[model samples]
Target chain A: MSIRYAILGFLSANPLSGYDLKKLFEESSVFHWSGNNNQVYRTLVELHNEGLVTQEVQQQADYPARKIYTITEKGLAELRQWVLSEPELPQIKSSFLVQLAWADQLEADALDDLLRKYDAEIHDQLIVVQEHKRRSKTSPQRTPREAYLWEAIMDNKILYYETELNWVRTVRETLNEMGKDK
Target chain B: MSIRYAILGFLSANPLSGYDLKKLFEESSVFHWSGNNNQVYRTLVELHNEGLVTQEVQQQADYPARKIYTITEKGLAELRQWVLSEPELPQIKSSFLVQLAWADQLEADALDDLLRKYDAEIHDQLIVVQEHKRRSKTSPQRTPREAYLWEAIMDNKILYYETELNWVRTVRETLNEMGKDK
Candidate 1:
């Protein structure tokens, strides 16, 4: 549902082929669509059907024909409507937390191991988010305001990861304290 | 998929009817399953079919029969496997962020309105998380370690909300700064 709007959002800026959009999404790792590449093509086809986007085939001499997508005025209006709609509080549905809730059944050592593993993963994610922030700075087409909003988005991801890492360590300490009490 | 494991985790603690499971899930709001009540019933059926749970129907004089589900040995084994599985870094997916990415097209005042709306929604969610934390503490069944884990889950939700609120304000200020620059 959101991928459609995001595609339209991307097209609102400039016309892009599926390949170009895919590349944009890759660079957009932090808040990219949940689905893979096929979802992009599939959404483009659906948008074409809905008249939200127009596609033109660009024939290349050496490469196969490429389909370029541009958002129509209708698509822009739709995207605008979405922006003005009520913001649903984004739910943090963490399965790791679920595991923590019921993982009392696991031995303390095993549970601590899980927390350690999660902390390690968060560490790696922070590195990737740094890369995202770096790459995002290179997009010169965005206006100064857009650039600021984009940085805010990156900060959100970084804040989330940092909080998770802190929580993991806190839990680990709690687990150790419990073990010591035993 | 995570919900299935969560149900098994609940059953591992005690046998429960579908209705009872639903109530537990409601109280477990900090990390509750994404699906509605029907998904609980559907998952229970699937678990029974898979021989991971056994269903016993109890007939009452004044009420209809209720199905009680008990996790089988297989279910316990499956839940353990899930707990031991490598943790997946939970992707932070916010369609709000996606909107922020493209919403530079909107008037500055309009974008700030969206951010303010988001801030208000997060405020409301923090209230609910507090209520959930209060309700969670009343459960006498959890061991000390389990209780600690539950509190950590609450902390996780609180931290997320706080971070999001902070980010929203930061973005609003950034918008203001950009407006000044213009």
Candidate 2:
């Protein structure tokens, strides 16, 4: 799956312990993809079983020994193959949309309240995304190419939220019009 | 989950046999939500266990006996509760974005090819969505309110694909520019 390839891609960049991968995944933009500690460890085990990654335990002076993972040559090859392969269609399951689909079941006033609440939620999200974009833009650590791709991802996220906000406003306006007519 | 409520929503509209539910699910816009027969049946059993639904065997003259499911009062209450509750945040796991995140690993040509292929795929999907919209508009069985909600869902789908198509084109252009400067 894409998670496996995401792991391989991270490993391809540099060697990382399971704990390190978990931290990086959580702290980075990759958090949007949402991999948890258990998933990270389980995926590492699977990748090791597949001979795509190797693990070595490093003993520390005072801390507990930790296992470090490195991508093998096969891992790199597989990662490249995955990058160039056909991307899987995104699986979208929007609970908001589901509610909207059945919105007619609710009274006009109740539906108006629902849309207003959802609109506020999306507005908060848009602020977060915009802040992330601002931070990413100023970060000197990113290579020009990396920055370009990162911006692309951020732009995608921004556009998505904006589109949703626009839809919410339009739906709210239409609902208001319907109410007035009645 | 949402699927349970989706089933309840449909049953709230009308009593349906298991086979009827399966057919309706597959043939309707609800297919975007992605439920299978096994899941439908399993959820039905769960709903029955919860006293949210009841089933009766209806004998057909030409066909085998079928179990028809009807939403109980509890089921209707649950469905309305779900419709009014805070919607879950949409979980997005886009393989294309995953690929883009690691795209620097691939050669420029390979990345270019990937974008082109993705663009073509989105174009094909837009055609399908547009066709569905046209058919839904002409369906006379929908009430004015139902038609409005359905149109909102269709508009959401159309906007999403359009946004994706635009992103694909922009990314491809940026990649092309990156290639020329190199």
Candidate 3:
């Protein structure tokens, strides 16, 4: 459902084909569609079927026709409703957390190995997001508020990753203390 | 599959019925099963069929028979492997971020209202997690390392929430500055 709303949000910005939508999501620092690439196409189909979005097929000389999607009046209304609706609190479902909940059985060395690997992955992710932030520029066409909201999304992601990296450091220090006490 | 491991992790501590497992998940600050649930029971069934867990039906007078599940040697091995395995990086998929991407259309008052409501939820959730941390107790039977790992898990959650709450504050301030600029 959230994906549906996101698609509508994108269409509201500009008329885009599924291919263009895929490109937008790929370059997005905020929302990356996970799993199959077809989710975008699937969601677009649903939106079109519901009459929230209209499709206009553009014929090409040397390529297959592309269906361009535009947000309808109903789509814009639905997106507006979703924007002001109370959002769901981000759920706590980190598998790593679930692992730590029972990792008392893991040998100290093994546990440290796991934490180090996890930390490295997070560190790499942080760098990727930082690079994305460095490349982001507000289009002159966007209002100041829209640009700020975009930056806010990026900041939310970056801050959480930074906190995770720092927590990993603390956990490792705790591990070292436990080793010394033994 | 991760929930399957979590259930196995719990069973490794002690045998538990499906009912007991549900209670454990509900009380868990580390992992909360979302949606219609029954995930625990479904996972237990899968584990039992896979020979990773064994169940004993305990019949009682004035009560329905309850099936108690214990992690088999296979389940224990699987859990240990998962503990040492590399963890997947957390995905960035906040619906609020998606909403914000298109929320430039929102009236200034409506946007502020949405931000305030979201902030309150994050604030309340942080308090709930902090209270859970305050009430947590380490069992005497747990080794020092085990206890610290438990604390690390709690610290991980608390720190992330703190970061999120702080991010929300900064976002609201950004909104206010935009208002001033206008």
Candidate 4:
């Protein structure tokens, strides 16, 4: 159901083919909020069948005609309704925390290895987020609100990465001290 | 499997009854985690049967003897393995986006109402996250790393809330302009 809105939101902005949507999602930091080719294609078909979007088959010089989707008036209304509606609260079902809750079962050596892995993964994420921040700057028409929103989002991402790194280091030190006690 | 670790982790930190463990999760934002009594009791029974935790009966002054659980070495070993391993990345699945994708089904007025609902919810979440930050500061013994880690987690929560709020506002303005065209 959520995927339905995602497609509408994109089409509301501009007409696009399912392939174009997939490309945008993968190539952008917004990839975090993305769908696969199958989802995009299926939804486009559904929307076209429902008359929410009008599809035009345009021939390419060297390829098969593409089915491009544009939002219909009814579709725009639906999109507007969705944009205004309250978002459902996200649920956290992290498997990482589940593992952490049972960390006492781990040997000191294994715990150290785990902490290291967490550190590295967080570091990698930090790099990706930083790159996203850099890319956002290329768009010249961003409003003040959009600027602040992106800043807040990037700051939060960086903060999480930094925090996780700190936690791993702290745990590593604590484990080392325990080893000395033995 | 996740529930098993949560029970074992709590026992590893200190011997606790099923009721006590439930209280701990509720009392602290340690994991921003939660569960009901039914789930708690069921996990405890499972862990006991698995020999991951040993239970001791302790009599209280005016109540039935409580069963306290302590983590077994075997449980600790299992927890260590989970911590060391890399977990599968969590995918973001949002219904709001789906609603937008199918927006052509809705009326203009309906769309506006949805945006207002989103605005109110984001504001509400922002208040809760801010309050949680203020309340967390009462604990003085936390290390700089722990403090940063906690702040970072809150920052992420706040960031997402702000992002949705800004998006709603922008979409609303766009809808208004499009209305004028009609």
Q: Among these predicted structures, which one has the highest DockQ? A: 3
**lDDT score, candidate 2, position A3:** 74
lDDT of 1 by residue, B36-133 (tens): 67989999999999999999998989998899999999999999999888888775567788777778778988888999999999988888888878
Candidate 2: tens digits of C-alpha lDDT, residues B1-182: 44887778778778988787777667665345544778889989999999999999999899899999999999999889999998655666678887887888677888888889989988887888788888873222346776787788788878888998998899889879988998
lDDT scores for all predictions? 0.82, 0.80, 0.80, 0.63
- What is the Å distance of residue B71 in model 4 from its true position? 12
Per-model TM-score of chain B: 0.90, 0.89, 0.91, 0.76
Worst 10 residues of 2 chain A by lDDT: A136-145
Give the CA lDDT, 0 to 100, for residue A46 in model 3: 91
Give interface RMSD for all predictions. Answer: 1.5, 1.6, 1.5, 6.5
Better of 1 and 3 by DockQ: 3
Q: Per-residue lDDT of A1-182 in model 3, one digit per residue for the tens?
A: 45788788878888989988787777775775652468989988999999999999999999999999999999999888988888777754588877777778877888888889889998998898888877774222278788778878878878988999999988987897778778
lDDT of 4 by residue, B1-182 (tens): 35566666566667889888787667544344585788888888887788878889999999988998888888777755555678533333445434443343456677567667767876897787778767764223234433443454455456556666676687778676666766
Fraction of the true interface contacts (Cα pairs closer than 8 Å across chains) found in each model: 0.63, 0.64, 0.71, 0.22
Worst 10 residues of 4 chain A by lDDT: A138-147
- Tell me, by lDDT, which candidate is best: 1
Candidate 2 off by > 4 Å: A28-33, A137-143, B28-31, B137-142
Question: Which pairs of residues have clashing backbones in candidate 1?
Answer: none
Question: How many residue pairs clash in all the candidates, one count each?
Answer: 0, 0, 0, 31
How would you encode candidate 3's per-residue C-alpha lDDT over B53-144 as one tens digit per residue?
A: 99999999999999999899999998888887778876545787777778899888888888888888888988887887787742212677
